[model samples]
Target chain A: MYVILVYDIGEKRVGKMLKHCRKYLNWIQNSVFEGEITEVKLKEMVGEAKRIMREDEDSLIIFKSRDERWLDKQVIGQERMSTDHFL
Target chain B: MYVILVYDIGEKRVGKMLKHCRKYLNWIQNSVFEGEITEVKLKEMVGEAKRIMREDEDSLIIFKSRDERWLDKQVIGQERMSTDHFL
Candidate 1:
């Protein structure tokens, strides 16, 4: 499944946030991260990422199908952002 | 980024498990499921999927990067299941 993690973060700290997520999530592919990803595991990743962030930092992790209907609608409604930013 | 959801389920009910995940997660394209997947949203999906299953059914949603080092090592140790099952 195509899991797109959209983290809204500061331009200065986005790099650090991505790196932390990559390490905690063990991400090595485009935007993909993996482990024994149960609900608990997922929560742990988010918590760890949150802990690593500054007090004002925030992030969003979006998971969806490549052909997700709602996402397609979102792309139509919102300005389409390049996937390369995270990739 | 490839997020693979490995659902451990009954042989009889695997099809339904996949379908439910597809609907709730909005999966399309090679095991990809997309939604505004927050920790809460992920929990909701898991709960919904669990509720839909029968007493004999079980499932595990394993999300990982396609190049997850741990998963690659797992593939070396464990049997590599075909991706087609979820795709």
Candidate 2:
């Protein structure tokens, strides 16, 4: 599936979360990552994310689609990071 | 259409952006919003966003789908905001 993951992590653990997410997806902007992965990989990534997050304060949300073609994306103003290489 | 909008705005202008987005979509997390809206409303929102953003430093991204059913959302850890009312 193709996914866009956005996270709001406590200041202390955010860097670790960023590093871990980078291993599985494209870092598109501040605290935002997206890319394609299998169901197994997605499950594995979520497990790791749970470890880095604080249940009381940190949160991660994933928006999933069966494929990229099912979604349309538009960017306005400056793009801090690009996921274009994946194309 | 259903759209998921995420933004990276300069600290000074972020509050305004947040307020503006809330008028059109459900706040799902920090800097993240999702909900259904007309093509015209989306365009209007984008236009207002451009006015508040500095083209060199801020960026707004919108991920659109034909309908909410076409996408799946998963939340991990604490959800900063609830978007259940719309559902």
Candidate 3:
């Protein structure tokens, strides 16, 4: 499962979070840092992120997906998928 | 499962999201809106919230809890709990 984090932080603090993520996770980058990640590791990363972002009072969106399909489902609800022409 | 939405929206947009949530959920308040919510209803609220908060690129932390203990666990990691005096 992957951790989906959504927050609006100042440009500078974002840099800080990125630095910490790299130090802990090594070199990895996805469009939004998406990939296979365990809940423990994700929680660790989130803990570090909260430290940096706490000053700014940023909002967060962090969740573990049951699978790829569930993640996709949340991205686009069932209603939208039901009406898709490709299906 | 409950949806945990963490997004740092502008003061004005937060007001808007709160208004929408109240209308849709029919009066509910828990520090950070903790409770059971369907995926469909949450998707709708997030969709509307996005519209109001779009102006500010806010981060979000939205997740569905597998259970109450899991939620509590995330709030405090396993390592922390292992040393708990209460336990």
Best by TM-score: 2
Q: Give all TM-scores, in the order shown.
A: 0.29, 0.92, 0.41
The C-alpha lDDT values of all candidates are 0.44, 0.87, 0.45
lDDT of 3 by residue, A1-87 (tens): 644433445566766765565543322111123345677777688877777775424444344554544433133211111222221
Ranking by lDDT: 2, 3, 1
Poorly placed runs, candidate 3 (over 4 Å): A5-14, A22-34, A38-62, A72-87, B6-8, B22-35, B43-73, B76-87
Instruction: Give residue B73's lDDT in candidate 3 (0 to 100).
Output: 19
Off by over 4 Å in 1: A1-87, B1-3, B26-36, B54-57, B64-87
Ranking of predictions according to DockQ: 2, 3, 1
On lDDT, the leading prediction is 2
Give residue A16's lDDT in candidate 3 (0 to 100): 70
lDDT of 3: 0.45
Supply the DockQ value of model 3.
0.09
Worst 10 residues of 1 chain A by lDDT: A70-79
The TM-scores that each candidate's chain B achieves against the reference are: 0.45, 0.90, 0.58
Q: Model 3 — interface RMS deviation?
A: 8.8
